[model samples]
Structures are given as structure tokens and as C-alpha cells.
Target chain A: MLDHPTRIGRLALVGLGLIGSSIARGARANDLVDTIVAIDRDPAVLERVRTLGLADHVTDDLAAGVAEADLVILCVPVGAVGPVTAALAGALKPGAILSDVGSVKGAVMAAAAPHVPDHAAFVPAHPVAGTEQSGPDAGFATLFQGRWCILTPPEGTPPEAVARVRGFWEGLGSVVETMTAAHHDLVLAITSHVPHLIAYNIVGTAADLETVTQSEVIKFSAGGFRDFTRIAASDPTMWRDVFLNNKEAVLEVLGRFNEDLAALARAIRWDDGDALHALFTRTRAIRRGIVAMGQETAEPDFGRRGAKG
Target chain B: MLDHPTRIGRLALVGLGLIGSSIARGARANDLVDTIVAIDRDPAVLERVRTLGLADHVTDDLAAGVAEADLVILCVPVGAVGPVTAALAGALKPGAILSDVGSVKGAVMAAAAPHVPDHAAFVPAHPVAGTEQSGPDAGFATLFQGRWCILTPPEGTPPEAVARVRGFWEGLGSVVETMTAAHHDLVLAITSHVPHLIAYNIVGTAADLETVTQSEVIKFSAGGFRDFTRIAASDPTMWRDVFLNNKEAVLEVLGRFNEDLAALARAIRWDDGDALHALFTRTRAIRRGIVAMGQETAEPDFGRRGAKG
Candidate 1:
């Protein structure tokens, strides 16, 4: 923890969705801020902020939320970042640090970095955690606990501002890692974007199968399809925005995924048992690595209980 | 709960893997059997069957396991159905009921139905529940609890055998449904096989990533990759056997899946946000339907806790 009296002066959170509300709660829970202000286009969202007590002040005006704030966080969908940044550009305090909790870094940086105050810190960041549930009610104080929040600061950004931003997230129980924009987008495309696309695609296929029927897919899903549905059940608008925003990285990994799937399809068609065995065997090790890395809990209860719903 | 003696006169289990051992244990746990005879050509498996106490008698000899069995269950991998059936054709008792717990029904019937004794019942069954884990120790008596069991009995099979087998699975707490063999295969190929292939492919892509290191993939897996690994962590040999045995239905579903995925990839490449959004939106309803049907639980705890290794 830095001794600079914390990054607790003032905070501006744009948007009042799940991610935004979670950050507000998380920031307040850790006493990491002096004042929290949230902005959303919908007055209903402001009412939610009031009811949830997630912020000190709430307004439908994005610009009004940034006034007097020392830190401005964009928590809107990726597609909205550009327009929202433009709206708040003139309202941010001179010494404020600007960051985001967007899913894709390159797109988000492209959208918001240009409008950042030259004297201020433009530390583009992505807190890599969320649920399929949406709206203000879906968030909680501990949403980012033990999750990774990647900070993709542009070159020559003020180091002190970056450290303070890092401290803010760290106090809320996130493990912050610094990454280049390209690497962050590429990593997330494989880890999140592409996988989500595949899940959506498979669920789409199941939905379209005239012979199989939707009822059958639902009934027999415990075999494995249930897992895909769980992921595909995510908010459509948010996911579409992510895949669209991270096009290059998503397509690159998706190409690789296509090749592998085609090879597997070939193995199945040719009845190449050994090739199938080898690939399946190789993947088991990766699963072990994930379990070892503490990313996925080893207990079946978490997965099963999620699938059960 | 019947008044008559609950003991099965003699039972033959055709494999000693996950589901097979689970059935053995469930039967033993429920006093549902008088004698259990397990068969497998693999030496290690025979040792496992004995080690797990899955049988009153165990052997690498197929004939020995089937010779006096009043009920014969083909619980081997889908690919093994044909060979095992051929091996045990002459050994089955005259009136013994022949059933299977294969994942793919049409193929199971194609492989085992022709060899069945005319007087014996051939009930093709699939219990649509499993963890990615496999092997004797991986099984528990509760594996089938609250799961769906599908029976694709041949057209002329005796009603009594179906009822008996249904009673057995019902005792284990599965809800049983009936469908034609071909229909069952197609339904499962879409619901189980294709989704598994998609998960396996995405996980494979993550493993092969040169851009994002494996450690990074593991660390950030909760972003989405972790769920795919849960499905991909399924047993290799068993899955290899599944694809090989259920070739037709799997190929058909895979064909549809690839076409749908290609369409989505094209939409992403061309920045067709509407198309992506529309498809994603459509699939979300299916998820809601699954939730309504009690197939999957909703996302309750988005705040992930550490895996208890």
C-alpha cells in the first residue's frame, strides 16, 4: 500500500450496469475512495444507484459525474466507450486519472485514449471478470475478489498515477497486472472472446437442429451441452460488443480454433482413434494447469451447481 | 419397494469404466443384485474392477461374465460395443435381457442388436449424466441422481425387460424417457457430442497459443477458458470411442455446427454487429428455456471463490 493518503479523493464511474455497480460497491466496500459518483443515460439507473447506495451522487449526465473527480472510470460496453469519452472529455479534472473496465484493451484504448487530458494519466485498464447477469442488481462488493484486473497504460503515462490506480484495484482484492494493449486483447480473445463465440455458436447449432429438437437438447444436456448453454446464456448485447470490438485478436485465435476443430472432425470421420486420444490427452494436462493455477476451483460443486441452474 | 426379493439373479457388466463401476456400486449400495460379474480384456481394468469391489466375480473373459447373467449390460465404450457383442453372442443365457448404457444409441443398437438372442430383450439405454472424470474410483453411487436416462429399445424388444431396466435406473434416481434409437443418437450428437467438440477445440486453441503463454491462459482462465476446460477434461479414451462409434450422427451435427460457426466468423470478420447480436439474443432465450425446464441453474455466485484443490 502506498502512503500517498490513498487514491481516495474522488471517483467517477460512467454507466450503472453490472460492472459499473460492482466497481462502485467494491470501491466503497474497501473505503478506497472519498466520493463515488455514477453516471448513466437512464434515470432508472440513477434511481438504482440511490437505492443500492453505491455512490455518493448519481446523475444521468456522464459529464456531470466526472466534474471534480480525481479518477474517471468508463464502465460502459466497449462500443460506447468512444462516444462516452467524448462526452466527458471536457468535464474531467485536470489532475484526474482516466481508466476503464472494458473487456478488450486495443479497442477501448483506441476509443478513449485520444480524448484524455495530456497532463492527466490515461491508464487504460480492463478488469477481467463478469457474470452473464446484467443491470444494477447483479453486482456485489466482492465481484473482483482474487480476479485479474489488467492495466494497459500507454507508453510515457505518469508512473505515480498508474501505481495509484493499481492501488485502488488492489485494495478491492484484485490482482493487477500491466500488459501491452495488443497482448491484452490477444490474450482475452483466446481466453474469453473466442471461447464465448464458440459457446454461442454451439448453442446456436443446438437451437437450429430440427432433427434433435430443442427439448431434447435441454433434456440430455448434462452430457456436456449444458456447459455451453451456461456460457452462451451470457448477455447477448455485451458479448456481441466484445467480439466486434476485438475483431483481429478474436479472428486470429478463432482461425486456429477452426483448424483444430476441423482436424478433430477429420479424426472422427476417419476413425483415427490415436489422434483423437492424443489431442484429448494433451488437453487434460492444460486442465490440470488451470486447476493448479487456481483459476478453476477443483470442487465439482461449483460447476455442477452452476449447470444445475 | 416391491414386495418380492429385490436381488437381481445374476448381472453382467460389459465394462469396468466410470459408468459401469457406478452402476455396480449403485446396485451394491441398493441391494439390487445377488451377484455381479464384470468383464474387460484389459488387465488393468480387471484389476480395477476387483480393487473397486465392483463384482462378485471378475475376469478378462467375456464368456465367463455373460454365461449365466440374467441381465447383461454393455457398458463398454461405444466403439467396443460390436467387438464385445460378437465375443459374448454365444455365451448369453437364453432369456437374459441385453441392455447397454452407451451414450450414443443408434450406433449402439446397430452394433449390438443384430447379435442379440431372439428370445432376449435388447434395451439400448443412455444415462445422460457424467463428470469429465472417468475410471472406477471416479464413480459414485449417486452419479445418476436427478439425471435423465433414455431408453432406445429395439422395436420388438420385450416390454417386461424395458420395465425391469427402467425400474433399476429409477431406483438410482434418474428420470427415464423413451425415444427411437436413431432419434436419440441425433439428439445427443447435437446436445453432447458437438458441444464437447467445440469445447475441446477452444481449449486446444488456448493450449496452442504462441501469443498468450500457457501460464497466462491458466491464470486468466476464469475469464471463460476454465469452463471449456471442465468439459474438455472429459476422458480421452471414452470420448475417442464415442466419436468412432457414433460416427454418422456426430458427423451430421458437426457439419451443421461448422456451417453455423463459419457464418458467425464471417459476421465477426465483416463487423456485422447486428447479425452477431441477433444470433446471441436468440440463443439467450434457449438458455432461459433451459432454466425454466430445470435443466440448468441460473448464475447465482458470480463472485468466484478459490477452488478447493
Candidate 2:
């Protein structure tokens, strides 16, 4: 076995939410970071972090939290990335690497780039992993295991800094991929953002229906709506920021989705069973590919039955 | 324990897909039926059912299979309910209660009603439970445990038949509810049909994207797309029939969904984070209600992580 040295010294995390705390936990569990400093605007969150012992130090002060850190990651909502970076950029150590875990990369890059000092490299990354749950306690050390984390470093950034950021995420059990911020945003819009939007939209539609009572919808959700509700139940502030920041990509993908959905509705209206069957069959192949590639669980119903039984 | 008599003397299932095979397994495991006869249009399904020992008697002849059955369930797709009933209704035993497990109750009720013999009663039921898997091999004895089974017996049907059918489902561990077939279709249109359509649509859209490669979409699916893929991978013929049969209600609900989605799109375009946040927040409560009502798994990620680990 090869000796794995600590990749980050005095790692400072801004916002001890799900992503931030998971990074802290994963880094500590894997010995990837020498020291973890958890920073959040909420005092209660800082208190919870201390109680959970998730970090070596917990603070509400941005500058004090990040001072002298080898790596600083902003794990706040995409909308907050700009403000947080602006507030804390001046305090980043000369050689420290600045990164983030926002879902939308292009907006995050645009928001955070100007604030980042010339001495520090800004690497925007989106870890394509998370549960619908939020808060400090919702994170686990193994959350990033077997998941994809895309790093979108701006043009002309040092290769060593990009490589180091890649090493940090890989050390925490993530498979890192490098891509441009614009491409990352477009890819994520179809893969994550639009999916989440439709989920939220469907859940809202079901809830507001006058003919179907909420009680009936709740009782009968096991049919399919329950699955949508799981993702729709995700952190609202985070998702809201995601949609706002990734507006162009999300809307572009959503336009294609609407057009496809219209065709499906037309098929159903015209009683074109073959068309619906063809589409459904094609979709099944995509799922099989996802499962075969090990991105999704192979167990039926996500092995949800085992949890109950 | 109370002495529980067999609810069904001889059960004849018209299709040996996921629902049919599950009924056989649940019935046999709970001693709800003394004998089971599985009939399918496909000989392979019959052979598999026999190999699995899912039923005492397996055959492809619909009339021969229902010779002396006390209860005959048509577990075929919604589109086949009419033809299957027309083929088997003449053979139903006098005093036998007939039921079906189609998702669209109104269409099933209409299609099967005129063909029912004077001495036999028809009850259309929608079991609001299933995995995406299909076929006889994909079933388990506990599939219906603690799940909702809605019974829609046509008006003026004998009360005893409805009671006996309810008892049969309850014996198989389902919580039974009785409603009008029309209302059941309308409710399920929003709860199941439209949700399925959108899931299928989004998956198809993602698959057809020009800019984003399918590999990237599959790799980054954990962000939320994987959940949609699970349901989108369901039996194509079954779902295609569901949308075709429940066309009006599905179209009606889908219109409202489009309207709500348009509003959400407007909010995103205008960067109305508050509106997006409010909707996302409201949707979370619905998920809580689903979990509280025991209709969904409360464990995070549907316990998929545990399965992987």
C-alpha cells in the first residue's frame, strides 16, 4: 500500500450545510486534510458543527475562519457564492486554492472570479452527489464515494492548483472530471436542474388539485409521485439559487423537455400506443446504461423495500 | 392468532406479469387462497410461473384456467382488459367475483362491465404499489404489504362481492379503499399517469440532447435524474396502455402541470428566487406527509446507499 499524504492543510469550509459538512467529514475520515475549519453564517449551525465534532475549529467569522488555510471551499447556495467570495476573498492566504461545490458552474465562476485574488486559483466544482436531506447532521463521510465531481477551472489557472483540487476531491472518494464552466452548466441543467424543476412542479400540481384531495394524493403517492416528492423535498434555498443562476441552460433544456412532453401528450391523445411504447422502451435502455455504469443502484425500487422490511 | 379462513378457494390470474405473480406469491404465502391458477397469453410466462411454483396450476387457455375459480383477476395491461374480459367472461364460474389490477379503473370498469355474466360481479382495483420491474420473476410475496389497494366496484353490484374482494386484498396485507371508478381514474391521472409521462419525457429529452453526451448524463445522474430513471424504466406496454386508457384525466392533469411549470419557468427567467423558494418549500411538506402516511420510505435516498455499501 502506498502512503497517502494529507492533500489539504487547514481546510476552511464556508457554510456548514450538507455539502460543506460532508466535505469536512469525508476529508477527516480519509485523512485528506490536516485541519478542518467549519464556517457558517448561522450561529446555530456552528454550534451543531462543534457538537458533532465535524471540524477542528468552528467559527461564524469568514475571515478568521479562512486565515492561513491551504484550501478554502465555499459550499453555500449558488446565489450566495458571489457574496461569500466577495466577503472572504481578501482573507484567503496568498497560495491558498479557492473552490466551491455549487451545482451551477458558469454562474458560480462569473460570480466568484472577480473576487478571487491573483495569488489564489479559483476552481469551481460541482459534486454530482447528494441526498434530499439538508443541514449538518444530514451529511455522512461516504456520501461522495462512487460519485462524479466535475471541476471547472477558469482559463490560464495553474495546472498544479487544478491538480491539487482534483487530488483533494479524489482523496475524499470522488471521481473528478474536468470541463469548462459553460459546458458543465449545460450538462448539469439537463441532468439535474430540469429534473428537479419538473419534480417540484409535479408535486405542486398534485398538491393544488381541487378534485384530488391532499390526503388521497398522500396515500396514493406510492404509485409514482412519491419518487418525485423525494427530490422535490430538497433544500429550497439551494435549488432556488440553482434555477436562478443556471437560468439559460435550465430554460433551454426545459424547452426541449416541453416539446418532447407535448409530443408524448399528442401520442396519448391520438391513442398512438406504439409511439409511447417506443419512447418508454428507449428510456429503459438509458436506465440500464446508468445501472450498468454503476452510477445508480441495481436493486429494484432502489432497495427501498429492504429498508421497510 | 385468530383462525383466518382462506379468503379465496381457487384464484385464477389472467396475466403473470409483476402484479399477477405478486398476487400469486402474496396469496400463497398468507394462505389466502387454497389453489392458484395462472393464465397468460404467452407460453413462456406460463412456463416461468410453473418453474417458480407461483401457482398450483399454470395454463395459457383462459377459459380452462377459470373453470372453477372463486375469484378471477385480470392482471393484464389496461389496453388488454377489454379483450381479456371478453374472452374469459363467458367462462367465469357462477357466483365467482371478478377483479382486475389495471391502473386505470374507469377504462377497466367500462371495458369489463358489459361482458360480465349476470351471476358474476366485477370489481376493478388499482394497487397503488409496484417496483419498476416486470415479469413473473420480478415479484415478491410482500409486495402489497401496507400498500393502498383501491377497489372500484360498479354501482348496484352485490355488497357481498365487494366485501369478499376487500377481504381478499386485506388478507394479502393491503389497506383497501372503495371509490367510484371515475374518481379513481381522475385521482390516479395526477398521482401516477402524468408523473410517469413526465418522467418518461424528461428521460427521452436527456437521451436526445445534442450538446451533452449520454455518458455525461448517466455519470452525473445521481444529482436527481437517477430517481426518474427508476420509474421511467417500468414496463413499456403497461405504461403506454395506462396513458392511452386514462387519456382524458391524464390530459386534464397534464394541462394543469404545464400551466404550473410555465409559472415556474417565468419565476426562474425573472430570477424570482422567493417564488421558486416558496414552491420548493411547499413541496417539501407534501413529501413529509407521504412519509408520515407510510406511503413512502423515510430513509434518505430510499436506502440506496445501504444497498451499495
Candidate 3:
């Protein structure tokens, strides 16, 4: 028998896509949960979940799928959380914990908190882990290993309920952290949303340039542009929902980014090497900090062979 | 004995930095050159190069280093290329090929072209491969393996000299391609220069944010920001020169990028999910094209285990 703690009786995962399927796989791999009930609005997704044996019971009916589940995780896009949470609000059992794996915590809490019953716990989470791929087949059992899963529980959320959700994420091999919903949204805007927006915008810009053909861009992309494309290639629906739901914080960070870019452009145009060197030196320190903190690989050349595997 | 074509009787690398050291190591590994002479303005770097045995000989004299070399490769910062090229112009032997590994081709060609003796060939080349690390200790023999090495030879330059340089790069395990100086600049402006500027700008912006502490940004950077930091952490002197030398192309691409980003920001503000989704989907296809073209890896989760080694 595998040695593990905090075994969940039944876990209901809504939206059987990347995160949902990964959670299902992880839960099963560690025997973290006894029963996994998968739910998705798309019938084809339900079929795939059943085929993969990802869930003990796969169903289209949200209420029926989650009725017996002790832990219910909403894994839909950020924009869909409000409607989806409302749809299943009547079904969650008393004392059962409810949570989500959405990128924008504020919007998720706003949409789902209204429908969360007084008797049930609602904890919002954002797992800072993923690949460029999406959908049911794109998930694996160890996606969350050594990654962060941040929980943004509401002001009056019960401590015990928060612990349960944290325990569940830990069971799935994540380092758990807690913060406020608004702070989570703000922090993620800088770390994820703005970076993603910049990547998407740059890729679009590169494609539309008349001087350079798309073939050339694709051919020579190994020189840093390809890195942006990987982040830009993330799921359309998911990113769209994230930007729409977190517009406030995204706009704020983007405003700052444009200002900084303009200043750097001026520095370059005026040939101010000192300013450029100082900025580069500061940023290099940040990369070192990230690597030292174990959030990034210390390998050189992007771990060339490792990237191939 | 390793069999490699276009063997160099005497090879001189002008700058014992990352690219310079890597070339020395690669030439030694493949036995592509019989004698390697490494030169650098910094005495410490030359001492380190000598200590590492990366080159058969190390010297601070630019002229003495290249006088006996049949192949002289300038591996200095873009800003230093012109001055260094002029300094060594008299030292290159008749019919010897002079080349550089600078990121910007037009500026390099312009700076070094006027100084090239009629008897020698000046073929500008750029190997689109690197790690964020710098200096002699960070280089390895396999750095250029499977990487693209673009050559932009001036019009009417001897085809034999271009072919010889191409053969040498191939011996080091690089795929070589030839393009006009202007086209190379435009292509790289989109593929490299603009991306580096954006990464540097974003890291600077994140560092200045009062709402989010630097520690928080660094902690949560695994979400996406860390990737930009890697590129931003590249050599400051090299990139500063890249921007100054390639100012027009960089500004043009940066303008387009800003416009596209404004549109994206508007889409988010207006909640235009369709527009956002359409653009995101299109960019996704481009990434697939790059991966299919073998410029990128198809591995999942940033190839976590591979990053370790």
C-alpha cells in the first residue's frame, strides 16, 4: 500500500479538462481519494473521462455527480465559474468543502460566493502549474509536484475548512499558500496575466510584420521569441476568461509595463548604456533569486536535452 | 580520430566570453581546428581561458592573435565589433576569412565592411543559440549542436569564403542558412531583439511595483514571469549594443507590439472574449508550426526532470 495521509472519501471535479483530469489522475495515483466523480457539460468530454477511467462515476448532471462528493472542485474557465457554481449550489452537502482552480481569485470568489451555502465551505485556489497543452488527454499524474497551490478563502471562511482544502492540495503534491482574494488577483496579474498578455501581443505583432515573413519568424524563433510563443500558446478559452475576469489588475500592471518599456526605449535611443546596464543587472538578480528559491531550474541553456524530453 | 571537413590550420577567437569559449570548446571537441588562439581585452578572461585549456594559446594582443590565423572569428559585443574589426584589419593574412558572431548583421557588416582588406573575406554570422549565463566558465561544446547559424555575407563576396565559413559551422553541429543583411535584421528584430527588450522592460516594471513586493513577484514567478527573467538576465553589454546598433528595426517592432497590446487591453476592458480567443488560437497554431519545424521541444511541463541535468 502507498503511504499517504488525508484520504478524501469522494472528490467531484467539474469540467474534465487539463486541471480536472490532472487532479483526477493525481488523486488516484496517491490513493488520495476513494471515489472520483467527473462532470462536464460537453458529452464528448464525459465519454473521454469514462474511457480514461479518470472518475468512478462520470455524469452530465452537476447535481447528481457532486451529491455524494465530500470535496467539490470547480475546474471551469474563470468566466464560467459564477454560472457553474450557481448550478450546483443546491446540491453540495452540509459541512462539505467547495473550491475552485481558477486563475482569477477575486472574480471567482465574487461569482461563486453568492451561491455558496452557509453550511458549506468555499475556498478558491490557483495552482501555479501547467503546460502549454490543454484538454483531458493533456494531463498527467504529477503535474502539481513541487508547484504552488494558493488558496484565497473569504474573510469569514472557517479555518478548519481552509485546512481541509490545503490538505487536499498537499495530498496532490503541491506546496500550499494562503492569501486574500484581491491580493491573489493582483499578484497573479503581475506574475501571470501581464506576462501572458505581453506574450500574446508580441506574437501577434511578429506575425503581422510585413518586413519579416511568418516562415522566417518560425524558423529563427529559437532566439527568445519561441519562449514567448510557448506561454502564448496556452488555451484560448482559459486565457480569455482570465483576462476578462481580472481586467482591473491586468490593466493596472499593463499600464506600468508600458511606462517601463517606453523608458527603456528612450534609454536605448539615447545610447544611455549606464541606465540599460543598471536595469539588466537588477533583473539578473531576480532570475538568480528565483533559481535559488527552487522555483526555476539552474541548468544552463534552458536545459537543452531536458527540454527535448 | 574525429573526421570533420573545413579544418582550420589556425583559428583565432577575438573575445573569450561565452560564445568565444564555446567555439573554442567545440572546435577542440570536433578537431575542427588544429590550433586555437583565444584573445580578449580583459586579462582575467584570457587567464581563465588559458587555465581551462579551451584554447591552445591565449593572448591580449588582437593583431598578434590574428596574424597567423587562417580563420578569425570576432566574438565580442556588437558595440565592440567595429573598433575591434578596425584594430585587427591589418593583421588578417591575405585570403583569410574574417567573420563575427554578432546578433545584429547589418550593423556588424557596416562597421566591419569598410575596414576589410580586399584580399580577405568578411562573412557575418549569428548562431541563434545561447544560455542566459555568460563568461568562459558557462560555455560547453554542445551549445551549438542542432542550433541555427545564419550567415549574411556581403554581395560580391567570394562564394568560396562563405562556403568555408558555412562548413566550419556545420562541423560544430550547426545548421547554416544565408540571407541578406537587411532581411536578417528585420527577422531578428521580431524574433530576438524585440523579445529581449520586452522581457527587460517587464522585469523592470515588476520590480518597481509597490503593490506587489519583489519577493512576491519572485516567489510567484514560476507562473510566467520567470521565463521573461531568463531572457532579461542575458548579458547587458551585448543587448545594449544590440539595441543601439539595431535601433530602427527594434523601434518599428516595438511600435507594432505596443499597438497590438493596446488592442488586447481594450479587448479585456470591453470583455471581447471572441477577439481575444481568436488571436490566442491563431498564435497557438504558430507555436505548433515552430514545434513541428523542430525548433522547439514538444515535451510537457517545461520538461521538469530534463531541466535538472
List the global CA lDDT of all models: 0.82, 0.90, 0.88
Write the residue-wise lDDT of candidate 2 on B53-114 in tens digits: 99988888999999899999999989899988899888888999889999998877788799
Q: Pick the DockQ winner.
A: 2
Which is superior by TM-score, 2 or 3? 2
List the lowest-lDDT window of 10 residues for candidate 2 chain B: B1-10
The DockQ assigned to candidate 1 is: 0.61
Off by over 4 Å in 1: A1-5, A306-309, B2-7, B29-31, B38-61, B301-305
Best by lDDT: 2
- The number of the candidate with the highest TM-score is 2
Rank order (by lDDT, best first) = 2, 3, 1
lDDT per residue for candidate 3 within B21-101, as digits (tens), equals 999999888889889999998989988997899988889999999999999999999988999999999999998999999
DockQ of each: 0.61, 0.76, 0.64
Residue A34, candidate 2: C-alpha displacement in angstroms: 1.0
Rank all candidate structures by their DockQ, best first, as comma-separated numbers: 2, 3, 1
After superposition, candidate 3 runs with Cα above 4 Å error: A1-6, A306-309, B1-5, B306-309
- What is the C-alpha lDDT profile of model 3 across A48-157, one tens digit per residue? 99888999999999999888888999999999999999999899998888899999998888888999999899988999888788889999998888778999999899
- iRMS per model in Å: 2.4, 1.5, 2.2
After TM-score superposition, the amount by which residue B291's alpha carbon in candidate 3 deviates from its true location, in angstroms, is 0.8
Tens digit of lDDT per residue, candidate 1, span A170-243? 88788899999999999998888888898898989888877777887888877888777766878777888898
